[model samples]
Target chain A: MNYPNKKKSFQKEVNKANLGMTLESDIDATNRYYLDSGIAVIHKKPTPIQVVNVSYPARNKAKITEAYYKTPSTTDYNGVFKGKYIDFDAKETNSTTSFPLKNIHPHQISHLTSVEKQNGIAFFIIHFKPYNEYYILPIHLLMPLWENQYKEKGRKSIPYAYFKDNLHQIHFSYQPRLDYLKVIQTVFNF
Target chain B: MNYPNKKKSFQKEVNKANLGMTLESDIDATNRYYLDSGIAVIHKKPTPIQVVNVSYPARNKAKITEAYYKTPSTTDYNGVFKGKYIDFDAKETNSTTSFPLKNIHPHQISHLTSVEKQNGIAFFIIHFKPYNEYYILPIHLLMPLWENQYKEKGRKSIPYAYFKDNLHQIHFSYQPRLDYLKVIQTVFNF
Candidate 1:
């Protein structure tokens, strides 16, 4: 019921998020609900990290004295849906005008490419926070822009206008808020 | 050229694996080679862990003072192979006669069943290390026995003889040493 800061403004309104959860956490909750109910099996894989040192304080207690987050070798989320393999990454951009290409790394692009070849569903869930908008932009729609970034080296981001015209926009709700899987149904028909 | 101990004997050969680097590390190496060569995309998911406390020693360094291993929600390895979604866990048993049922948990079996319903390739790579044997035994083969464990209160382990008779045996090679994909090719005919 209370956030640390008592300051009231649009910032405070943004902090509430209705049920007091971020878009990412909401997706996580939705996933938990899905898995619990036998609807689907999806999970955000643990971020791969390197542990340099650790000490055992007790038989079961572990104290990691040193550790570092490593560059992930694959996408953040993956699982099966409707008898189809689904893989995706979720991104949030503060910029309301465009989604920065830098947010999508080269390794991730290649990972999606590999998944595509394997007939797995590959896409990005881009959330524009300012407008409270989310879009399920498939790899097919993104690959050309990704390739052109290197070929022409002119534009390094996708304009909001482009997304407005071509994206598979997803609506939010009270429970299972993101409902990107609903968009998956529309996109993949699975 | 050097292992911690230089001792050579059948018993010592078995002791080398107790360091926790035999099957898992080899598979990790195999996956790395596969990714580098653009052969097939597969990865061993990092074990999920719970962090209780953390402190930053510097801008670039983190000190996790407390943490604990968490129950994983899914299998250790999963990825796409030849346009097919694949998922499996690798289990090693010291027992010579049978693989211990306790090596597997109830959640993993349920996870595999869900994957099967979704048309994903689900199986177990059971490595009988003492005998240096590996079998790509699918869920369909293990389920009846698993169910029987509850119904008849029979042996909790699947005998080595049963695996040898029905398992999809694979050979080791210099590169991608286990060559489990080759076994998959034979078993799935892909």
Candidate 2:
């Protein structure tokens, strides 16, 4: 599938925005809009920042250069919709067949496990490469794949056919490119 | 109280470890340790990355620069704790008496408000400068002060006395520098 062209144009649209929003930013804004409109209460988790050396450019301004990425200990996003705790990760894959397990870390899978154990609604919004097709895969389905991969019996990536059949399709709208709450509503009645 | 003069000693410690762990990294490690041990479920959120350009040093390696900070749309940390969703911000302040409201954006406060409304647990881990004393101030308490700050009679920071009396004090331990779950346990019995 020729996904690069469509993905590039989508990237261009995001870059052309005055705010220069990224895919994550757009999703966040859309989530906030959804929250404000009383559609849902969801939020992206903040990136962990480790400020090592801060140069004071001014009294009120500080510049940070020396920093390292910290391993996140929880899922990317979580909140409540109609009294149900919603949890999920927003991931974009360039592969047409499946998202590579490498895109997800063991810690994230564990976090999802914890969320599921707590009876919270957990899933992932995966964007297929070149084709802008987005699908919502439940955490339960992901865990077994992750386990099988770890055990050396599963493929490194989930086939696109599996995604098409098992996952719920999330429609992209002007307001929320990956408006996933609608799928959540269908799955959890929230 | 004046903080101990440990700059030279701490720098020596930093050099001896050969680990360029930032304060954020240390916090993340601590949270991970706690989670792995089943002590608590907490995570530092992923930073919002706006990757405008990516340089491929190697086919598998991509170095990102020329990116800007995207306005965060959610709280920094959140997870499940004994059937409740825990959410909060870990802020370091160099003030002695009070924490500045300016440290938190209006949108973040709104996010916390929404979390509180959903029956999830939300609070802030405020680190007092020099003293290193940390306190967990609930969102419910912070909201009113945040709102009243614009009434022409509002204080810029929450006084230490208010924190001491109302907020739960979190002790800095070796495992979890800002071990706040203990406070949560006391407050919510979880």
Candidate 3:
């Protein structure tokens, strides 16, 4: 665990070689590292799909012919870490100054709210593509902004400065690309 | 929460109306009840599928043309319950005298083992169809039986008497068809 702090300096050099990968892939790599090392058990839930038609091509082989993506009813990723239920969604924004609120579905907000009520750790891994910066925002901090946007007709997006000032930044690394759990260890003090 | 035990007497009458429903649908209904009543936040993960081709017939309406079901890498159900991470899979067997071990996948067993190591509640909801019986088997209890099958070349199935003697039976009710959480509260002492 002490190695988390020591891995910081090599982040930039390692991430430069992985510039072609998407945020989703980086997070997947990070989860794989966590799982393989026995540090945690995290996984990205497969995208939900609605199958309308299926054709049996041969014995014991069925192929789906018609289907559509379904909006997920829960967060993208969830698992157990340090004896706590961990839940979160990963999002990337093209805008340099703000992250659009629409990027987070309402169902996820409701689901995370329920998670928080049960004392599970709920959060977001946000990536600012233009700046190549990553931050972890706990559901508690996001709840106020989420409410204000709907109740008070506040800004539809969260300014980059808000995240910079209020949230914990996640450093990119060689093995676990995003290293959000390192931030979790510090933020949650686990 | 205190109402769990009180609802036991109404089981048979309510379940008779849902005689045609499968075990999966009953679990889904039970989870919905838990969620709506603010008791728990459990969910069954969507079936994983590998999509090969998609065509956009119109803007924002992509239709999948080819896909195949993928084997799941983890348990089917997981979420936060009473601040504890709960993970499990539901299974059914038509055999009258024994529950086949092959009904549970190797990946699911491995995933549940990891969940248990993290202090998460891990178990299975098993239904013996001919008897219309349901039992909750904790991962801790199942682990030895799982290992014995491979190491000692033991019996491939668990006898009906074993479940009736060792596991907690789940009563079927109107609101939550399979009241497995009630058994959890008693078994895990949450």
- Ignoring the other chain, what TM-score does chain B have in each prediction? 0.87, 0.81, 0.87
Ordered from best to worst lDDT, the candidate numbers read 3, 1, 2
- State which candidate, 1 or 3, has the greater lDDT: 3
| Chain A TM-score of prediction number 1 | 0.86
Output the worst ten-in-a-row residue range by lDDT, candidate 2 chain A. A54-63
Model 1 Cα displacement at A107 (Å)?
Answer: 1.8
> Which segments of candidate 2 are over 4 A away from where they belong?
A1-29, A44-76, A80-85, A91-107, A127-134, A149-167, A171-179, A185-190, B1-29, B46-59, B64-71, B92-97, B129-132, B188-190
The digit string of per-residue lDDT tens for model 1 on A103-182 reads 89888888988888778889999988889889998988899888787875568899999989988888888767777888
Query: Each candidate's interface RMSD, rounded to one decimal?
Result: 2.0, 3.5, 0.8
Candidate 1: lDDT of A74?
A: 87
lDDT of 3 by residue, A1-190 (tens): 4443434544653574365348878988988888888888888898899999987665456699999999899998999987899999988877889999998899999999999898889999899988889999899999888888887658889999998888899988787788898899888777
Report lDDT per candidate: 0.80, 0.71, 0.87
Q: DockQ for model 2?
A: 0.25
Question: Positional deviation of A51 in candidate 2, in angstroms?
Answer: 8.7
In terms of TM-score, which candidate is stronger, 2 or 3?
A: 3
True contacts kept of each: 0.49, 0.23, 0.71
